[model samples]
Target: MTITPLSDATWLAVAGPGRPASTTIGGWTLVGEVFNRHDPAVRQIPDDDPASYEKKMLARFWGRFIGVRLDGKGRLAALLRDPSGALDCLWWAQGPVTLVASQVPEWLARSAGAGWRINPARVEAALHDPYSTSGDLLIDGPAAVLPGAMVTLNDGIVSELWRPDWLARSAPALSDDEAAERLRDALDQVVAGVLKSGGVLAAEVSGGLDSSIVAATLARTEPDRVRLWLNAWGPDATADERPWVDLLAAHIGITATCQPRATGRLTLEMLTHLTLGIRPGLAAMDALHDADWARRFVAAGIDTVITGKGGDSMFIQPADAGVFVDFHRQRGWRAFLSRANIDLARWNERSVWTLIGAARRPRYTPAAIDDPNPLLRPRIHPEIARHPWLQGIDDLGPAKRRQILGLVQGCGLHGASFQTEVATVFHPLLAQPVTEVCLALPTPQLTLGRRDRALARRAFSDRLPDAITTRRSKGEMTAFYGHLIADGLDVLRPWLLDGRLAAMGLIDRDRGDVALTRESLAWRGGYVDIMTTAAIESWVRAWERRLPGG
Candidate 1:
């Protein structure tokens, strides 16, 4: 990637291996991977019509990109990421030098002056939910552009271009059958497009509904070019997911290779080499993938690996509480009560009146609870917590609301940091066309009769088996994460209690040491929190190593 200065007031950061081209539409200079989906070498951008170009860019349903356009004379610039943010773009301003790049570390390297400082409040917010970006740039003034957002920089001020009202306008306009047919067609288009130049395509088959759908679709469509891979564990391990995996492979007439899960003593010393380049604030669990798998892909000449990630996000999986609301709004109180009672019974929630009250309200109000932080919680500024990119958007109708929430929460999206190291991970479910259709699906078609992902079940019923499609209970990785921490807790000790977070006054060392005991780690959500906290610690250490003095 090279940072090309377009003009006195503007610059473009180009990354990846594509032959990027630039075109001047009106007064704006547009650059980055803007190409034809059918022929990447061919530019599909409209040169004569600026308005048409804007429409096409925003409405693009597929392909990878990090496009930017700048009007230097006007002192304005715009940045856009792919729909799922496959290519990440980060920008930070230090004095008069403003830097943006696909890699955050690269941008920081070019930063001049006093250098960047950690935002303790941002660190606290990241600990709250590590999976979500939470709008923290982790620096004093640097900011990250959110997925699907179009950010404009005007006179040093940056603002995002996402209208919630615009998304609500595209609500489901077709019947159940029509929606199913369209979704299937869109899935086919996305999957087929991804496999068009297929060379040793492999997919992660977890035996779950979503992966099954993707694996089965691939098997049916491009059986000759694809293989299945499963991350296997001992039968005694709660993370074991091979039975269903074998079942699906047998049904599809394909062979699957099971890769052993990564195990053994976990320690900061072992991860020290990896910490320096680790993406700040990402959960440590994200880095827990088996290295052997990537090597296997290389050995087998696999270039791309398909996954059923973002399936729930795109399809708006069955909502436990909100389904009642959709039921009441669509049907009368009678139908709402009937479905609510059944769902409540399934969840062991026994208040029909309470359910009705929940349904009456647009969104459920959670009871005030104690903070999840085990140590002294850092004081965070209200502005930091309420960053526009981190804030919840309102006014989007329920279906579209679910989809956008999933995207913002970052479902099915993988980090681009490892794009070149491992086999390219493709998520057809998150394809713009598929995601748009699924978001437009009527709420009833999604959660009616207490069936989650009903649209998907109906759409790919023939391709998947009855057992796989009908299974309702999803697997959890609590045991898996618990064991990961248990194996490495000793090595992660110093960082957990006395790391950068502690030095920043974001956590109390004494209290954190007491709170992070093995006994406490066994509690529900405890392992996950510990893992995330450790990740933050590792990131802080990484930053310390990269910057001046410890």
Candidate 2:
């Protein structure tokens, strides 16, 4: 652990290995990996005003980092988290003193003793949504400094340093070809920048357009640095992507290692023994595969694991009526009713009249909370915690609003293995430059009024295999997750039905019993929900055991 004093009454504490390296310039301290886009040496903050400093920093630097500036009296003046959310900065008041850290300090919680308690409301909110990126801390005391936002420590005033909607609205209008060219350049630059950092890099090539693009870019940038191209295949045909993986490897002239995903399937023991974080970090059922990969990377002396995680969100992959809505709003009725209408309708396999009606009355609904556990208690008004980006987006078209929401969802992509002890995980697609570029382009342009991520496909068409660039089908893990649930029922039954969540009034015993039965599991098919609930229950139990009496 490293503690750096930011002021007489405040300090920044970073725990665990690979703590971000800090650099001090003009009384402002930058913690984590940061690089100035224009001039690498220009790290000093010229402006004294917080707002001006924020503007300057946003315009100049691009990387995962946090900036903290102090007053002449050695008091913390302002702190800002980078837009990518690659680094975490959480703050909470400990009696009279304010504490800031990269994560929930376990020591502090232990010291608080009885005073520290889990925030049930926050936990319930998380359970209700599961996909929200509101960045609410699970414990009652602390609050996360959300990505692309800042805080005035002295006054406890928080404001936005970066706004996705503003960027979307202000993005310059560009032709399709122009957007593709700019996107290609941004991807190249971001990938190259990561490679320049130097590491025994490994990349997850999932045989999808996104991962393939990332792997291709890595090869194009510094092929020799990448030690492994890892791909996980499932037993079922839907989950088998080895053919695509082989094609990508052959195209890139690098041997790829394909492993069975079931090797790291979630087990009862794995759930109970999970390394707990501030909240439930196990976002996906297959997250254990990450831990397995981490061990392999560590044994092989790998320093970084690159992925194309944010590609779907950044490239606007969802096919929704919002696209047509945005076309009508931006390009006028004439354009929307003509080529745009036909294109969107044909892409979605819907009639022009249906598309017109959808455009006229577009619905931007959040994903429904679909927990199948009968014991799950009902809230008066259960809703996902609203993210900062979701606010002030009422004026935008549904597609743009959904695009921003996609970005919000992308913030939680890191999940459990966000910060591994040995190898760092890097998502080049989530870089600030790439995010901004994607946000700037209109939704129609992003999807080319046809397929998802059309612009991205165009951008990397030359570098990647035609099988990848033009490939429409994506590998599914439904069968893999289904098998996991079916196989683990022996442990999952008693674990969930008798777990902490049930005792805490979150799960209903009778309903849980019915939900876990073969009949119910087959009919409802809530395996994913059950897995999510089990993970959350495990997290709650883990933290409860950390209490003094526990």
Candidate 3:
């Protein structure tokens, strides 16, 4: 860990080799990886106003970073976080001093000593809405510095550094081919930039469109840097993607290491050893899978693992009536009714009349902070705290609003929070530059008012296999997760039924018993709730054991 003093009162502490070294640029101390859009030219903050500084910083640079500047008296003036959330910044006030770090610092825990206890509100919030990006920490006290926001240290005021609405308002009018070319350029630059930094990289070739595109891009950019191509297959045909993987491997002229899905089966012992974060992040079922892959990446001395994680959300992959709404609003009734309506209808597999009605009065709602688990005690569920990005989206068309919400939801993705012990997992698609370009495109252009990720297919068509670019079906892991939950019942049932969560009255014992039965497990949706509950239970146990009196 490197600690750099910004002022007499404030200091910056950064850890991990994946994080770039802190550098002083124009009197501001910046930490984490930052790339200046205007290369070779440095822009200085015009004044001490946090708002103005934030605006200038947003327009000039993009990456996973945090910046801080000092006042004349050698005190911290302002602090800003990157828009992509590629790095985490969490802070809590410790009397006159405000403690800040990427994650909860161990020193604070040691300071609290035996007095530590899990934040019940955060636990309830997580159980209520596991995917929320609210700034609450699982361990009480510390609050997170949300992505694309800034803070005034003296006044303790926080404000947005970047807004989603700005991107929407500035969306350029471009033709299909023009938009595709621009997107292609953005994807290439982001991928190439990461490669230029140099590292022992591995790309996940999941045989899906997104991962395949990433793999193809990596291969074309700097193939020699990518030492491995990793793929995981399942026993069931639905979970297998070996054929597509092989096709991509052949196209890229590289061999891929494919392993059985069962190699990472969830086990009770694994849960106990999980490196606890600010919250219960890893899906209980995916705990072993992530650990297994982490071990492999570490053993191979891989520095980074790139995956197409945010493609679904970023590419607007969901076929919904929102696309029709966006088209109708933007292109006028004549164009929408004549061409877009039919195209969207065909895409959604719905009749034109149904699509029209739904578009006129879209029923799709944002993801609510409510748990579907029958075992959860609803009374303790916390009040819904909407993420900032979801605000002012009511004026947006259904498709665009859902698209923004999808991005917001992606912010809290398990992979975003989960880090391998040593290797850094990078989602190049989620980089700020690529995200801004995609967000600024019209929804119709993004999906062609028909197929999901239509523009993405057009963008990388020349480089990737035709089968992968046009592939509609995705590998299903429903059976894999179902079997995992079924097999782990003996361990999961006792662990959850007699766990800390139940003792705290957060779970209904009677309901949990009914939900964990073989009869309940037969239903496809039942396993998800069970797995979610088990995750929370494991988190509670892990933290309790770490606290003094437990």
Candidate 4:
């Protein structure tokens, strides 16, 4: 990808293929790839109020874009980022000169003159929380144009323009069946938009609700244009998902190419291909496998790779506490207690009072933090530790609000991090329209009968098999994470002992190694902490090699 500086106030980077449509409307110049809508006629560009023009545009538009309108004097009037934040927008400002680009490295490279060095604090934060920056590239203090907002750089003054809270609107009053039908239609539109890109579409089907729904919908709707790829973890692994994979594939009537689970230690050779700056935990490792699969798609003439990534966050069921509150508020104490007992039983809770206490807490909080690695907590920069990781949004329902905000602020960042150069990965479930409908769903519709993701299961139950639609437990990739540390002491000694992260005082080598050795079999957050720290070490090594004198 080439990052070309369009001007002091603007820059451009093209991903995948096709040129970004650029037009001069009125006295303003707008550049972006408009999907699901025609290029905004210059006449559509509001003459007196540029901010209103953005609102009007977003009210009617859908697609991944980074757009900026310039005044006749070549001054930036407004900058727009996609609502779903699918495309990354990295920008750094120095004095009056503000530089922006789609890729992080490009932004960093240009901002080097602005005294932008790798921040040890941010780097360590990335290791501790991969979803740090809410999926925006925030390692070096550059601001990302996150979803549902616009930035204006006029007269060297930068201001943010926020669009209305469209996603959090109440669902049209409809019965469960009607809601499901509506959801199915929205998903169809999102999938159809992805297919419009043309060429063969290959979906990742792990037999999970999200992937199964995507793969099944595509195969059922456009069987000729879609193919399925299942990452079967082979026979030795207990509780493999291939049975469900096979069941879904058989039901869809399309043969799925099962790619055996990836096995191998993280090799030095693989680290050499790592992208610069801190990436999400095990991102490079995940990319290694994705790239391999992408090659097969390329050979098969498939250009678009769709996955079920954002479905979990997007089609979120209301939080248990929120559910309890809703029941208590809408019905009576008896009803709330009835539902509360069911939840307690399902969760195997120790006490109903304890669940009740937790349910009473606020849904959104500045302190609703992640369980950071204990070892890493001491090393984290004090300021970073104290800073609020997630911002609170007021317009959304507690459950849907936090879920979508988490998606945009946290998991959404991972969307682009897992992409391969050969194939374009599309998360149809994460599309703005799709997610909007998901957030608008009535609470009961989403979690009816105390079932999680109930709306999704009901929406496409007809297209999916019972095994997939009814399964409660989510698929795990412990096998994959375990493989990273499968070699134990020898595999990570060199990197962990004296690598950049340890050298920066961000991690204690002896302690990390001991933790890894002590719990090699435990594929949980401890494993993630070790893997993420190691991935950061690998990234540091790659960046060091690219220095003027290594």
Q: State the weakest 10-residue window (summed lDDT) of model 1.
A: 33-42
lDDT of 2 by residue, 1-550 (tens): 6776666765776665555577765656888777666432124334665566676667677777888887777766778888888777877666666566665545656665455677776677666666553477666666788888888887888888688897788778799989998888787878777877777889898999899999988887788898888898888899899999999988987889998874544566677755346657554445567567767888779988899888887887775567777777777777554676887778778888876776666454433335434547785334545667887788787777877877777777655452365667888888887888888888888988887888899988888889888887899987677767777778888888898777777777788888887677667778767877887887788777775566
- Give all candidate RMSDs, comma-separated: 5.0, 3.4, 3.4, 4.9
Instruction: Residues 382-498, candidate 4: write the lDDT tens digits.
Output: 555411224444534455555655465433334434344566667778776676666666554576636567778888999999878888676677655565665654756676776
Candidate with best lDDT: 2
- Model 4, CA-based lDDT: 0.60
Q: After TM-score superposition, what is the CA distance of residue 337 in candidate 3 from its true location, in Å? A: 1.8
lDDT on C-alpha atoms for all candidate structures: 0.61, 0.75, 0.73, 0.60
Pairs that collide in candidate 3 are: none
Candidate 3 at 178: error in angstroms? 1.8
**Candidate 3 off by > 4 Å:** 2-20, 38-50, 105-108, 112-117, 262-265, 283-285, 362-371, 379-382, 414-419, 545-550
TM-score per candidate, chains pooled: 0.82, 0.91, 0.90, 0.81
C-alpha RMSD between model 2 and the true structure: 3.4
Clashing pairs in 4: 134-409, 134-410, 135-413
User: Residue by residue across 389-432, what tens digits does model 1's lDDT show?
Assistant: 33454543354455565665552244532423556677778766
